[model samples]
Target: MDLLEKKIYIAGHKGMVGSAIWRHLQARGADNLIGSYSNDLDLRDQQSVSDFFERERPDIVINAAAKVGGILANDSFPFEFLMDNLRIQNNLINSSLDQNVERFLFLGSSCVYPKKADQPIKEEYLLTGPLEETNESYAIAKIAGIRACEAIFKNKKKMYTSIMPSNLYGAFDNFDLNSSHVLPAMIRKFHDSKINGNQPVKLWGTGSPLREFLYVDDLADAAIFILDKNSHHPLINVGTGHDIEINKLAKMVQSVVGHEGEIFWDTNKPDGTHRKVMDISKITGMGWEPKVSLIQGITQTYKWYLQNINSLKMVNMYI
Candidate 1:
């Protein structure tokens, strides 16, 4: 079905990727894009989620929200990462299917690939080996979401597609050094170090792991591409098909942020996976390619960080 002006509900519309999708749809003249904050909709509750699906009855759905955090948060809250993500995804997928949504898209992560998968991983590399222990719980839940979408696509020939995006960062990213992803974490570290008299920044691991990163807006563009194309892939990898080492990433962030401070790596921390590149040929074959290069994306993100230094920082709420 043509998705122009379709009632589309993006579950995690406030996030980096979801927000980008929302803006993209706005520019595309889709005036009916709808989203609700988790506080209002509590997607983790099955009955509530099912009721919302029935009530909204959106023509299209994009599952982009999850309990995303860094290695420290994941290691500390494995149960929350696993159970919350499971509940949120299961409720959304089940309710959307029940409501007979015309097209559904589930956003997965590259961490679903095996920890030791081949460089430039492919869609077929999922579950090929052990997952990285740091984010295994979150990764497993995402894997379940992908499997659910695949099952629906297989059984009903539905337009249920799952996209595994590489590590994403952008304007609305979490920059909390303790709980944010690597890119945002590095940004915060460099920013703080620069602001506080250019103190040397201490980073985790040996900075040897090779990783892939995609800009969140580019990911949103790909989501729109898939939605507009009425895509039917069980799983497709979305990335720039490139990779960089952690040390190199740090240097790039430092350069972009104008931080002249030295970077000190604490090798005591685990480097996690050695490499996690994506074989984005599947999505490329589908005519969607990432437009933003890493350097360009990082510079844009740093500009955003400079613009919203006070707001983008995540503050943990205590009860």
Candidate 2:
């Protein structure tokens, strides 16, 4: 199948991951990409989503829409994070199946794995143990999505693929201190402090948790590469297979932002997972490797944050 000629629908095209995928597709001369803002279409509305699928009849669908946030945001709105993501992905998957979409790409997060899963997490380790309490709701929703896609592919012989990516940060990332993820939140906090007389930045937890981050654009490239190669694994993990401690990551962001502030760790706040990195051997063996290094990705993200500081908006999940 010639992907460039296919009508592809990318849900959540305005957000960080979706926007990166859209940009990558455009750069690769894919001109038939389709997306709509929340105002135009509410994915949670089953009738609306069914109608849209019927009307557009896209050849392929990429499920990238979700209600995402850090620990505090997830804890504060667990119901919304769980229900909204469930609704959005369920609607898209059902509608795509009903429309007989040729191929479906469902994007998931590394959090789908168990919180205490073995380090350098592998795809087979999913659901082996409990999830981090803070983001359990969001993780359950994503797990449902992955299972849905897997069932569809196994039973209906459809080409539905789910890609689970590690912590992603890049342009268009949410910098809102309230709901943003660790990387962008760090970037925003450091930058803000640097401008505000380099006030001491207070970070959550003990700064002892370990995390692995992948550049959003690299995730975009991996998704397309998987599709192009016709690798129809039920679920594939994409990451750099590297990890870093929170304290070190914060120090890196501080250096990148040139913030001359003392770092303080708040033990009261939850640290969430202690360490969550991906075992990317599957994707790497499939000939897809992450391109951007952590420091380089952080620098680029900080640069984008600075360039769009004046026009940045609070990134909220679409219902």
Candidate 3:
């Protein structure tokens, strides 16, 4: 089914990735798209999700809602990351299958792979090793979601696809220092450092670990690509297929925000993994690649930060 006029439901419509997907779909002339905030619908309840499916009966489902957080948040709240995420995905996927929804796109993170998995991580190396201790719970939940989609596809040839996106940053990103991911947290930190007379910014770890990031818009476009092509692969990695050191990333964020602050690395903080770079051959082979460069994506995020400074301030209230 074409995106146009198809009833599409974005589970976490208010979040960075979900909001980007909704906007991309609308921009592409997709009508009949639907979404609900947390207040209107609690995804953790089984009956609530079942009733939502009965009422909305959406044609496509994008399972983007989850209790996502940074390493610190995940380490602090393991149960919430595991239980809440499992509840949400289980309810949504099961409900979608019961309704025989034409397509279901479940969004998983790159962290689902084992911590010591081969560099340039491949989808096939999913359970080859151990997960990063800091975020294992969240990763486990996402792995389950990926496997569920794989099961649906292998057993019934259904259009249940999973996309394991690399680090994403763009509009609607949670900027709270406690819960936000590395990119957004860096943006927030640099912005504040500049405002506070360019105070030295203290970052975690020894700044030697490497990581990759993808623009949320590029991810949104990939979602459209998957929906258009109805790719049947169980899982595909979504990323730039490149990486940068944490120190270099800090410098980039500092340059973007015009912060002249001295960088401080506290070696006392644990560097969860040495490096994680995704092999994009699977998705690139499918003829889809990210367009936005890392610097451009960061610039875009900083601009959004400028415009929504007030909301950025209030974001901390949630933590």
Candidate 4:
């Protein structure tokens, strides 16, 4: 398809994952990249999305926009998380289909898998059982997006596919405690505590849940790899294929941030899911694998956070 010559539109180009993909594409010599901010174009508005696609006529569409957060944010704003995500992806997918976009890529999370799915969750485990209650609404919306791509690929024979990534963290990550994911949240908390006289760092849940994290850039690389190959897999899992307990992750973040404070666990809080890891054999077999180790990724992420701490402090106001 000569992806470098195609006009590509990344829906959430400013976000951590999307920005990484955009940079990766640019580095790969994709000159005709396109993107717009929410103010310029509301993805939830079908007419607006239709207009943008009709006007831009991008050859490839990457759906990376979504209302995402941690357990607290998701639990508090379930409706927005569900409806906003559904609207954004629905508009993008349908509009691309109507506009006859050459290729489409939908980014999803590991949360799409069942809460009680077998260990080392595989692509087939989706919808096998109930989802973790904390983020079920968001998961449902993502599941719908994946199925939408699957249907189009199955019937219309288009190159629409979904990539489910596990716990991504990197540059441009949301460090706002209220809405950020576990990894970024931990980084922020430990950093703040370290600077504030090493105060005790209180963390939610029992620090027992296990999670797998992939650097956002790795996900971006995977996306580019798929686009270059024009792979037709309906859905593929992108992750490190390994996991660590929350307690161990906390210790690592604490060390990275140089926080010597006592770690306190809030037992009253929910752990969300006991374990959520992806089986990356599918993507690995396709010649794509994560290059960043957790320690290296976290070290780089912490460095970014330090450089952007002043601006990040204002993030809570928006949330």
Clashes of each: 0, 0, 0, 0
lDDT of 2 by residue, 227-314 (tens): 7877757899999999999999999999999999899999999888888889999999888898899889999998898889877853
Off by over 4 Å in 3: 317-319
Better of 1 and 4 by lDDT: 4
Top-lDDT structure, candidate number:
4
Q: Write the per-residue lDDT of candidate 1 for residues 148-197, one digit (tens) a residue.
A: 89999999888898989999999889887667889988988898899988
**lDDT value, residue 69 of candidate 2:** 89
lDDT of 3 by residue, 160-273 (tens): 999999888999998898888888988988888899899998888899999999999999999889888867577989999999999999999999999997998889978888
Between candidates 2 and 3, the TM-score winner: 3
Which whole-number lDDT from 0 to 100 does residue 4 have in model 2?
A: 81
lDDT of each: 0.89, 0.91, 0.91, 0.93
List TM-score per model, in order: 0.97, 0.97, 0.98, 0.98
In model 1, how large is the Cα lDDT of residue 2? 63
> Could you tell me which 10 consecutive residues in candidate 1 have the lowest summed lDDT?
310-319
**Which pairs, if any, clash in model 3?**
none
State, as a TM-score between 0 and 1, how close model 2 is to the true structure. 0.97
Give the CA lDDT, 0 to 100, for residue 146 in model 4.
97
**lDDT accuracy of residue 283 in candidate 3:** 90
TM-score of 1: 0.97
